[model samples]
Target: MKSILTMLGIAAALLAAWSARAAIYDAIQFGEPGSEKSHGLESDDSEVIRGGLDEPARILLPRAPASWQGGSVKFKLRVNPNRQNYVTLKLWGGDVNENLLILHADGRQVGYRSRGDIGLLDYGSPEPAVPGRFYYVTLPLPMSATYRRERVEFEIVSTGRIWEPGRTFEQYQKKMLTPSRGLYRFYVHDHSYFKPPAEDRQGARPEPVLPPQQPESFEALKERVNRELDRLLGPDGRFTNQMQLLMAAEAAGLEWSRACRNPEAVRRIVAGLDNCYLRWREDPSLASDDRSAVYPAWTGFGPAAEAVRLLHKDLGPYLDEELRGPDGQPVRRRKAWADMLEAGVRHLAASRSRHPKQSMIVDLNLYRNNRGLRLLDPSKGLPPEVVLGCLYESVGLEPWSGPLDGKGKPVLKSGGSDRLFTAKRLPKEFGYDGNDGELPALAAAIYQATRPEPGKPGDERILGVLREMIRARSFFRYPALNLAHNPVMRLETVIGWRDMQFPGDVTYVQRPESGASVLQAAAAVLEPYSTGIVQQMFGERQFFPSLDRQMEDREFRTTFGLLHVPEHYRLLTAQPASSSRLPMSEGQPDFVFSDEESGVLAVKYGSEILYASLYWRAPHAVNFLARIHHVTPVLERLATVRQEVEFQPSGRIFVRPGWTNSGVGAGGLNYPDNVRSIHAGETLPIARLPKTAGTGQENPLAGRGDFYKLLYGPYLFAMNASSREFTFTTPKNIVYKRLPDGGEIAGGTVLKVAPMSTVVLRRAR
Candidate 1:
């Protein structure tokens, strides 16, 4: 047989280099490489190796602590393939407790690529050849794995076994776990990751959250700044890395200093800042090719700029203070500040790959770092990529490539029913990234980057994004209970009625809590709903980290991009906070909001408030392909059982006659179906769920209760979170009433809701 590896390298030589150098030019950080064991010694078993017609052999990758960061494994093996009995491979591992390749990263939360998408040794497959002689193959490990220690694992399917036609690997593997009789052996060798760039990557300190926005008395401002100043001078404070506290000190510290008639406090702040500045500038770690550089740059720079601004008058002597950089360049402290700021900015700009086309890594540190740099070099501009940090574009909510058109007006989807407040981000009318926090974080960066100008807009386009985002997410708020008024319907991005499936693990219908942290602290635009989103996010969040870590694995950094967090809006501008918890209310003069693009209409008619999604948001790659939007994936505590079901929200239901999808396919493998089969009225029972995959009940989560419950929390408060409006039924209905002016029917379970809506009733006396 012709060989693919004859010109590449011999097996002996390939296996000899058990560890190779890092693959940095690839641009992704594949952690340090090289395996602990340096030998490719074959197994010493005396018996002849064999294979079972049903089960395959398992080969554990050599163990190395912290070394397997989304890399590949190269090994040598001796095998032969033919028309009938050829070898195939099935690689699998935990994406939670260990490393696993994460695919579909471009959409919502990326789907961890399930077992092996690697190689096959079938008739026309690429298996390094020599008939019965040995050859080499490389298996790349996944990034989002969940297993504890075994880090990486793979299998050998040489018996030419195939899961039943149309059956998935999930079902095939579930029914075939025992080691096969064909005990093949892999001569151990190299396990390594792609090389990472020299610039270190790390998270900035958590986005700072500030005190609420309430007009403060000079005395109050003085007291707060003075207290923060005290902490700054205290022994424990300097090491604490408290950026928020530091900014608070600046917000009113200057005034407080003047009020006390003491330049001493101001001087001390200057002194403290100078100390931090020099430490960061000279600390080789901050400027090195190592990982800590971005960390200090972001957390260190922003606060430093604010301090410098605050102490301008008092800095005559300090400005002349000289310092040496890590490179041994000596300059006045002011110039030194520019050098430090630029160094950090240049590094991040050089290293970061943040963009709409690639990853959703709106690193808060990068923005804070650049803001600090621009704060110094006023002529320099904020990175255009900063738009990603402010208005994120995910699988569903693809807001903008840039936030404006050539005319400099905000780019938004038309069809919002508001004049001033109705710029919609669902221009494409798609799903939402479950992270929820990213776009807000990016928008928050705009505030972090700009100084508050009276009538001037700082980076108008970016500011437009910030305003539009707050309006977009908060629009889903149903004021009375502060819960998600988001209108959603699944299409091809979701499961089909009978046999169709989308490409992603999640369709961008993000968690209601994605906007929670931002909601926790109110902002003017987040109004009416700032309190609402916060309540809604937290209310739903209580049900999870409910799924096991692996159930929905994603990039560690991607999680931080959700816009739900920004240090504090008050720090940016003094807009009053919606501090009051969402109060229950019937319509006062009729409150109404309509999103034509998203097909959502929210209306509060006195006591009867109704939220409805009249159509699918927009095009999803999944739905676009399937050419339908009838059936979606759903989970609810139904009139019968609790499980994830194929929902025809328009009232079409597919009822399977079984209690379990425990075993069905020829090899008993559970594959996803890509045919129109279920919708609103039908039940795609848990038993109907594939026997494998995240939505499947294959994992050890029995004690975790139902996975569907997390998504279908018709909570204790009569909140119906599912897609269908269910009768809040009771063993018997607990009745309630309204005053003579009350609008709707008295309620308990009698109240009805559209998907993700809520109803509150005052019980009758």
Candidate 2:
């Protein structure tokens, strides 16, 4: 009877522990990549647990010594299956804070994550439905005393076709045995554990101090990097983003080999080169306005383009020394500029759909030589740059798909009038005759860099012209990217730009094995050919006030040219040849307001209306213009509204019927009172009120910005920037009773705030 029970337990352990790492039988040493020392700690009879038909219900993972710290528990799972089967795995941990336990099935199947604020083992997602092979799972168990007793559990279940009632034993054995090929490997290393004191279990001890590994000398580092690159990237020259970046690091290593003679020098050079190249290669320019595009140029410091020429020149010399050449010149081993660029283009082209917002083809031909709207109307066909430029422009901030105003001739503002269409005549019409000179310099620098000559002054010329030309652009007039295009590629060159705000954290990290993991750590990969950025950028659709609001605020009508015209303007990410500001008649304002005193008090912009009503405790404020005669559809006329209001005696005033009799003076009316009583009144009158609300004791008018729904959907929640955190609010029509707080208001048709940050009312399925 005791043997029967032991066998049953063993079978269960074998089934469940198929994918988990076997318990350590011998002491092992694992540390930094190259230097691992194994201390004699493993006992010959160390517990060996196998998962077969059934897995054990609990596991006590290895923990760091109470005094000696710095150890991690690494375990592997071995699953034997003939056909795909659904499965779920749970892990127990010491720390209350949720720790990530990685599960890899078929090298691609990733298990779901469970996170919490407290210490506990987490149950993960059900496994693959159709599993055909043995799978491996790796879990990291930190060596902390806080974790006393816990175990990992595996729940394997069927998902697809159910087994028939009758099946031969041999048939089932064949199905299961064919898939279970070999024993899975599990490794536990000391590197994963943080150091801790021997006795204390609750408190964390610092990790054992280890000296920083000094990098090899430039020559040695270069050789090692080359070897590593060869091991990772074979002859194909095609690699994942991770591989490509590591190759880039190798390129940096080569540069370091040439730039620095010492080991530390290589480190410094490579560190400085990391972020700039990867990001710049992704997006070359990030101009604020549509009138200019910037590209990092290697021209200025005493013929910098020569560096390219040098690479071309010495490349043959370097290769010839290592290998035989056909014509006595060195053989070219690395990919040339054209080949690499072509490969990049091909890769992006194949995956163009993945990056819809960015253009795969950077055809300067479509932009630089475009003569008329018919050829280059941004609204009609892709201008190439808009989709392409966003790949760079949206870094660290939200992506943008707005019009390509930054690439064309600067619409020099007159400053006299804000409306460019009216106050500023076309540059040609005004006979300015000055072409945007920045373009030629940019073009020249690119030319020189791509084709630098030995003993020629091309490099100096390119750098000088590009440096001066870029500095003259409008964005540079303000605090800007402080770009200094010098030939030297020296760090000092950027120090003087924009009060010396140098670029941030641009170092590259190279890991030989996993490409995606490393790239994910740095930044979300902006798929070069994907429209995802465009969709996210242009998705921020802004709705305007209803027609009634336009009728009320003459200034808005004139400023945006949305008055009587009844036209709606959708700001497209792609720039159109021309766009009208008129509001569409079909367009509806989100809200409508009216009062008994004033028939149609005023309409407000969506934001303006939301702002006025944010303090729900306060009455709504609706300020309106009285004189229809003063309103103008022309934007030029609207420009005078601000000035006229500033100089007027009362600025803007409202007179009521019982002004003198009811203690209501014949002056500006109560805007807030009008807004609140809008629905209460039977028939409201329309009157123009004073534009400037004086410093009176009662409700005064501040600009429209002061009032609005400061908390709106899609407004990112940040520790800073937002004071009122965004709590999911129930949608209208669908009834909701519960607030985010635990207390429930009602439940029959309640708003359920799902785990996903979206509002769900009773109507929501």
Candidate 3:
């Protein structure tokens, strides 16, 4: 009997140890390369000082302290008698810069503020104050804080300050505190009283939300895009006349690619090439009638300019100057004229491989990067042959042969200079009898120089070019891949979903099976990287940083899910693999499965996300994705559950006085299916809820006590989905609760949610 008791105690202790969980660290100050300044309201003031206009400040705050786990924290400026000057201060960030709450230092409550509220502080007059004065600034930890460290602003609103004749005040703190470490970031509160700060004053900031048009229906958005392209490209498509028509055709293909339109549009754009030939025939100035005669390729200057530079083996000069290679080398020039000629031959090879007819019109639009096709164009004056030579060296192609300069050696060009063109000089006084042999010979020379080394393997350039065309949008344009996509997304919506899964120990796996790509597609148009074509389009950022090690494992699995969080953390993908068991995939892994055994499941009730990952061997796994949206009720439910308990809304609900409760739950609804135990209370039918159920045993939560009963009280509504607005009454004891997709919900207010959407209902205060 003694031995058995000891064994039981050991077993209990082991179980408790096994149940312990750790929170993931949020890295806030990880300044993304170009992401630091997308929409302005600088992410941080780590570097900003007094008079630091146009200078960026970086602030990073540590991840939200563990204490903020289930609660929302509100941060605001607190004014003491000493620092109360007529200066303007602006605060941004919590929920996209909207002012959520305001409180006086002495506890004078101004109530919860909305976006329409004026919370900015402007100092019109300067006051004297001692240094190191402490100001009480409180960030209320409400029950719904998402990011660990959000950017805060404290701007000096008054341009000039007035001082009393008798005395002067210590100059205002020259610079606000910006984090140099940690992830939480804050920026100075400038531009609160007037125009936007300098950083945000540049080109039109892309909207946070994507115009509500689908990319599949490009018709509505394409015309506006084409017009913009036309404006950027002058009448003559090419920036110069040196490029051959075939090369010009290639350039045209690149232009079609930038728009990322349907293949049909790309084809139509390319077909217009024939029109260019006729125009060249009629316009003597555009393309000369005589072969080898000097003619301006300016007709190709419009959208195709980037392509024209490729013919000379150079891409865009400005872009080349901006983009840096991994080795920090400035890759911007062609070496020798021989190298340029070789590049021409390579182009010809790729062209012939695709069109068999030897049509010089290579549709690079279809090319993928892996094949070795260089779609990123360099600038002009560099010979294409030079770049070809570099490629030759990289792949061990063959021996090179081309004209040498004064020293009598093969021309070897380096990046950043127009060496190829500088080396060649046409005769000072040349005659154009329409048949100068020079130009075409140069073109032909380029073609001959690019022959593949004596039969090593298939042409990489050919394959690469073909694949690149098909994946134009993937290269340098995916919003998800770009760090800037974050701020761009934050501008429109308050929340986004980033799901991470690791099959191996480190690497994040984006299996073709998980279908997480759907979210990428959804965010494409909504993020800043998306071509701003639709009005309904907005931006929202999501980040999934998978540890690098476990990426390639075919037998990959992990136990990760979001649960117990306060706010509505959107779902990016299905749950990850169970903790104790490895996730398995049979058949096509990409298809969506209804089987809970396949992975985990997340149940969203109001703003709360309850997630669980199951395994045949392991007991269970749960995690909180964000702060619960409806906190009072959830806490109440949690309080009641002993080991497990059923979760449900409270009895008291609120909507507009006259709003009808008929047809309230019309869309796909997600709710708790089973409860192990129920706290006897007046259950109210707030509105019709779509059929919902739990995958676990019937009444999975039955042991819990009245901890779930605390949720019943007056409620507020947040209408999230649908646009329709109507009213209805609940059965005598029932009530209606509405949650708005945007804005705050008032107690007793039934927010109108359009048909086919979600609404938030919190127990009324």
Model 1 CA lDDT for position 159 = 20
Q: lDDT (0-100) at residue 674 of candidate 1?
A: 18
Candidate 2: minimum summed lDDT over ten consecutive residues — where? 635-644
Error of 2 at 359 (Å): 9.9
Candidate 1, run of 10 with poorest lDDT: 632-641
lDDT-wise, the better of 1 and 2 is 1
Model 2, 446-558: lDDT tens digits are 32322223223333332332333222211111110111211010111011101111111111110111111111111111222112212221221111111222234433112
lDDT of 3 by residue, 1-765 (tens): 323332332333223212222111111111333433332323212233221122232332212332100111123332211110111212211111111112222122211111101121211111111011111111211111111223322221111121212122223111212122111222221111112233331222223332232232223223333443343243444322222233333323333323333333333333333233234434533321223322122112221322332232323232233222234554332222212222332332332111111111221111111011233332322244544443332211223223233222344442222211100111111100011101211222123223232112324552232222112212101111112222211010001011110000110111111201212221211222222211111122122221111123222111000100101113222222222110111111111111111112222233332222111101011110111111111111100000111123323222211111111122112112111111112111122222342221112111111111111123222211122443422223334433322233443343343442223343322
Model 1 per-residue lDDT tens digits across residues 1-765: 112221122222222112122121111101112211232222311122222222233222322332211122222222211100011122211001111221111121111122111112221111111111111222221111211212123222222123323355643322212222222222221222111123322111222232233332234323443454456554464523324324433433333243133555555555555565576655634532423222443333544554454445555576677766556777777666766655554544433322321222223433454555555566553554553333233212333332333222334544122221113543321222213222454454444444343123344454455655554544333221011212211111211111111211211112222212233224423444444434333333421221222224342221222221223323323344333332222224444444433333344444443333322211110110001111101100000011111222222112221211221111133324211111111122122222333332222111111111101111112334345555543213434432223443432344454555444333342
The whole-model lDDT of each prediction reads 0.30, 0.21, 0.21
Candidate 3 or 1, higher TM-score: 1
TM-score of each predicted structure versus truth = 0.36, 0.22, 0.19
RMSD for each of the candidates: 22.1, 30.6, 27.8
Ranking by TM-score: 1, 2, 3
Best by lDDT: 1
Off-target runs (Cα >4 Å) in candidate 2 are 1-207, 212-219, 225-388, 393-765
lDDT of 3: 0.21
